[model samples]
Target chain A: MKLPLLFTDELRGFYKSKLMLILWIGLPIIALLFRFAQTTSTGQDIPFTVISTIVISSLAGTLSSVMLAVSIINEKNRNVYTLFLIRPLKRRELLLAKFLSVYICVTIASLLAVFVGMTTDYITTGMLSTKLIDNTAQSLVTSLSMLAVSCAAGVLIGVASPSVMVGAILVIYGGNQISVIPLMPTILNITYATLFTTTTTLLTCSLLLIAAIGLFERKQF
Target chain B: MSPRNFRNQFVVLREVTKKYGGLTALKKISFEIGEGEIFGYIGPNGAGKTTTMKILVGLLTDFEGEVYIGGFQVPKQKSEVHKLLGYLPQSVGFQEWRTVDHALKTFGKLSGLTETEIEKRITEVLDLLALSEVRHKKIAQLSGGMTQKVGLGQAILHNPKLLILDEPLNGLDPLSRYQFKEVLLKLSKGGTTILFSSHILSDVQDVADRIGIINRGQIKQVGTLNELKEHLAEQRTVEVLLTYATDKWREFQNIKHVKSVEQPSVGRILVNIEKGSDPDDVMNDLAQLIVKQKIRIRGINLLSPSLDDIYQKYVQEGESI
Candidate 1:
């Protein structure tokens, strides 16, 4: 009950943040720009939906991760969690709420961008084939998995870093690299690409979240 | 442990000691607050007032102590204690994006209040804190005093049995301070036990039924205003006002009971009495000396040490050590 309440509070805060506005409006605009560029260029058979998913995933994932890490660090330094901690709320719930809120928002933004890209593909090419649908679904799954890893790493860096600058730096350098791990099997063309991305997402996200919770529980504030 | 006395005590700390590595923030300090009583925890900066409040609120857990809030041990039974406690931290911050109403609603819901109750309490708290006009305003838009009031509003939104406020009056204007003190007194009258910390002596002297002076992580003294004044009762001074400007009042210093004499103004002299001397005898002696010296006296009054004096004495003593 407390977790959900905190999650709603955090979601409401993130929903109105400038970062959320950028993700919601910026991602779709980027997809449209990609579609226009593809049409103007050589007009080759390009999987716009897959390309948009990858592009949106990278953009939304890094932005959301940086937002999470920086917000948490700023709030910690400002002692914003003092009032919340004094209530009947667990330390782990606070971190989990932040992670879930940012993850859900980024996921929604990613889906919106992918939908825009799919609509452009259908309009330009005038066909929705089985191969295209399969490719889009796989890309969407990989994108979501990558987001999970990035969000978890954001929380970890947020909990561990001392300041917002350090947290943002770590998220860009360390956290972005960690999120790329889920995209490994796809790049290498593994036998079970989907299965491997799913496994890596679960394992890495859980490990990062567990480490974050441990550090947060011991935190004095 | 000593004999358990839970008759009227709502919060109790026995031999509580907390340390950060080799630096001890709190020593073997002990104190108790009665139900519905306002216990003023006063100390200078870095005097462990915040550390003690944090321990009571269950924010700092690793410590050796026996702490009980409404008979529930802290950190061990913090969940149970949390239900009956409301805390406003010294340097607490709110999310700048959140409106005053939104922030209060979040705190209200987290406190397990029903939707209806939260709405009602929000209205009541906002009005009480004079923050109704800023209900829809973002926290970042509020002034320092308004923001501090919002912090107070959330702390009392749930109406817990015990409210622990750490430096709750730090950033308030004079009018806001008066109104805030009125709110505290009203809350106390409504049977809410409050333990507020402040370095402002006059504020504590006005609101606290019993004040605790802490310094160097040690409990220096704890008692009511008069009781603390009595601690320095023997060191009383008398203010003597002369009808005409003259230095003849210095003759009072030659009396046996008179310790020293100094003129604070052109016609007003302050006579310090000896420790064991009777104030009445000293007054009589000064009167006789003034008549003998042909000096006309306008008025004379005995004065006790102010809270400022007592606080400085204790704090300066701690600093010297």
Candidate 2:
């Protein structure tokens, strides 16, 4: 019951933050530019859909993680949560609300990138291939799973570390390194690669959320 | 409120102790605030005032003892207590992006009020705090005094039974301080028991019906202003500004109630008296004696210890230990 209010509040908050703009508008623009440059340089019909999907996935993974980490740490250090904690609100509701809001915003940004990428592919190639469709669809699922894990992991670091710099460093260097593993089986032609990454990511995200909630519940504001 | 009504305690802390690593923040703090009474919690910097407040409001749960509000345990029945209490923290940092009305609305909803109730209370609180003019203004655009006023507004919006305020007057100007006190007076009049912590002695003396002096995480004393004065009233000093220095001032020491008489300056004589002795009687006695001896007199003044003096005395005693 309380989560809904907190979710709406945090969602509205994130929508107004500069991070939203960077993810929703700025990141997609960069992905488009990168795809155009790749096509121009290669002089071969490199599918714009594949390049844009890669860019969005990679950028969303790193940017959403950093965004959630910094937001949680800043709120903690500034005692902003004090106002909410003194009420009937639970600690888990707060952390979970922030996680869901950031995750949802980044997911929307990724979907927008995919739509833009496919339209560009249609305009440049004049047709859509079945292979491109399958790859784009697979990449979307993989990217969603990876982004969820990264955002949750970032929240864990934010709650566990006392300083913002330490949390951000861990998210960028430590978390970023671990998140790349989910994509490995995909390229290696391992059996049920999507299943493997999806299962591992869901498990990791759940563990990270539990760890974050435990830390936040015991935190003194 | 009747004196008997104030005797019924509304809040109690039984040997509450809090420590952080190696540092002891609160050392067995124990006191009670009666219903409808303004209890002022006063102490110096780093004296554990905020810790005590946090414990009462359920913000800090890991502590060493018991706290009961309206007969409900803290941090366990915290939600039940939240319905009855309102808290104003020392330094409130509102989100700069939210407007004043929106921020208050959010707090009102968090306090479990419905939309209509939240609207009504927001209007009432804004009017009470004189913040109606800036209700829609962004928080970042408000001045310091206005910010403090909004902080106070949110605290009393729900009209809670107990209001816990930490350093509520930390940075307010004189006029704002006065207005804040007036709002508190109004709240207390409406049967709201207030526990206000402040480092400003005069402000405490002005509004608090009773005062608790804390130092080094220990409560040195808790009593009404008169009760505290009476505790130290045993020793009173009378200073007389005389027209001329008198070598015969020692002769007046024959009065049985007079403890000692000394002239530390050219035209001033200080007479020390025992407890329960009447200052007016001493002044009259000295006046009669001066007239009988044809002594020239300028003025007679009675100097009793103020609340500031009492606070300093307790703080110094704690420090000396």
Candidate 3:
């Protein structure tokens, strides 16, 4: 009963937020602009779909990190959670509701941007290549994993930090930077880099979620 | 429901102590609220009124000792207790982006009400609290009074058995405060057990069946207005209205058991009854003296201590508001 109510309420709240609009419409427009700017400078064919996918996935990571962090901190400081906590609601359920709502919204926005980039490329190139598909798919998976880790880290910071500014700083500078740790072996040209990155990212997300839930449960609000 | 439990206790706190870091927020507080009783918790700022309310609402689980609501242990059977509770947190903030109706709907759903039942309750509470006109307006655009009403509305949306309101009238205008008090009284009359906190003595005195005054994280006293005044009966006053004014009323001070006498107005004499003196006996003696003095008498009235006096006397030493 509570999960649906909390989830729907959070979705409505974030969907109408100014930051969500920036992620939804502004990110896609920026990706299209980057694609156009690239064709004029490089002269050689570069897949606009691939470029847009990479740009959007990256934006999702950084944006979701800051957004979820600031949102949770503000809610905590304002004591908005008090209304829910005093009811028959669980601490884990509250955190999970917020996490799932933000995650789903950010995921949809990222995919939309990727779709726009793919459509733009198809329109311009008149053909899609197998290698390009492989590269775009790989980037999509990496971006999503990084985004998940960043979102979880954002929750951890929001729960642990005593102030909103500190939480935001941790999310923007610390969490955004650390989200790339799982992908580090790829730069070193290691074999099975994808497997290593995915496992470590999921484990890190699990730990961060556990920590967030524990802190929230013990928090006095 | 009957107004009395087997032991006449609907809520009980036993040696309930709460501490924050090194500071004790509540020091071995113990009290009982009878079934269907309107229990007012009053204290100065930071006097642990909110802390006690939070513990009762199950929002604070780290406190020592136990609190029972309807014989169920709190924070352990918190979810079960929640079914019977409606809380309006002090200075609570709603999602300002939501309309009043939407906010109520969310809370109603969380309280486990069906859609049809919630809709009916929405209409009932909005009309009851005079919030019908602003039901569709966003909370961000509401006045403080309107927001307070919304908080109250959500609390009562499920018609809870126990209503815990912390400073529900803190920032309301006088008219709104009066209206809120009426709502509380109406709920109490309908068999709801209300535990509300306020610093406004008049508001507490008006609606409370019993009052608890806390100071320095300890409960100073708890009783009905009459009971508290009777407890502090060392000094009492009787006001007498005479047909004519007199400066010679000071002579009556010499009468036995009469501590002092003053003419607050030309024809009104206020006589202070000394401690341990039977006010009835003193009044009988004073009547004979007044008759002998040939003072044309209009009326003699005993004045009870006001709630302000009682609250101040109990909360501090020899302090009067």
TM-score of chain B, per candidate? 0.94, 0.93, 0.92
C-alpha local distance difference test of each model: 0.89, 0.85, 0.84
Per-residue lDDT tens digits of candidate 3, residues A1-221? Answer: 47877888888887655556767887788888888788798887578777776786577787787777887888888778888887787888887787787777777787888888778777877867888777887777777778888888888888888788898778878898878876676667678878877897889888989999999998876
Compose the digit string of candidate 1's lDDT tens values, residues B1-321: 111122499999999999999999999999999998899999999999999999999999999989999999998998899889888888869997999999999999988999999999999999999899999999988988888899999999999999999998998988899999999999988989999999788998888888899999999989888888888687889998889998677678898878889987899899998898789898888788878888887898999888998899889999999
Report the Cα lDDT for residue B197, model 3. Answer: 94
Error of 1 at A89 (Å): 1.2
Best by lDDT: 1
Model 1 spans > 4 angstroms off: A38-43, B1-7, B246-250, B288-294
Give the TM-score of each candidate: 0.95, 0.95, 0.94
Clashing pairs in 1: none
Colliding residue pairs in candidate 2: none
Of 1 and 2, which scores higher on lDDT?
1
What candidate 2 keeps of the native contacts, as a fraction, is 0.52
Task: Kindly give the stretch of ten consecutive residues in candidate 2 chain B with the minimal lDDT sum.
Answer: B1-10
TM-scores of chain A in all candidate models: 0.94, 0.94, 0.91
Q: lDDT tens digits, residues B1-321, model 2?
A: 122248678899989999999999999999999998999999899888999999999989999989999888998899898888988888887765778898888888888889999999999988887789999998879988788788888788778999999999988999889989999999988999999999888999899989899999999999888788878778888887878777767766976688899888887888998778887788788778878877777887888789999999889999999
Candidate 2's docking class is: medium
**Segments of candidate 3 deviating more than 4 angstroms:** A18-21, A40-45, B1-7, B241-247, B262-269, B296-299, B318-321
Q: Which interface RMSD values do the candidates have, in the order shown?
A: 0.9, 1.3, 1.2
lDDT of 2 by residue, A1-221 (tens): 58988888877676655667677887678779988787688877667777777886788888888878887888787677877788887889888988999999999888888888899889877889998899899988888888888888888888887888898889988777666766777868889989988887888889889988998888777
TM-score, B chain, candidate 1?
A: 0.94
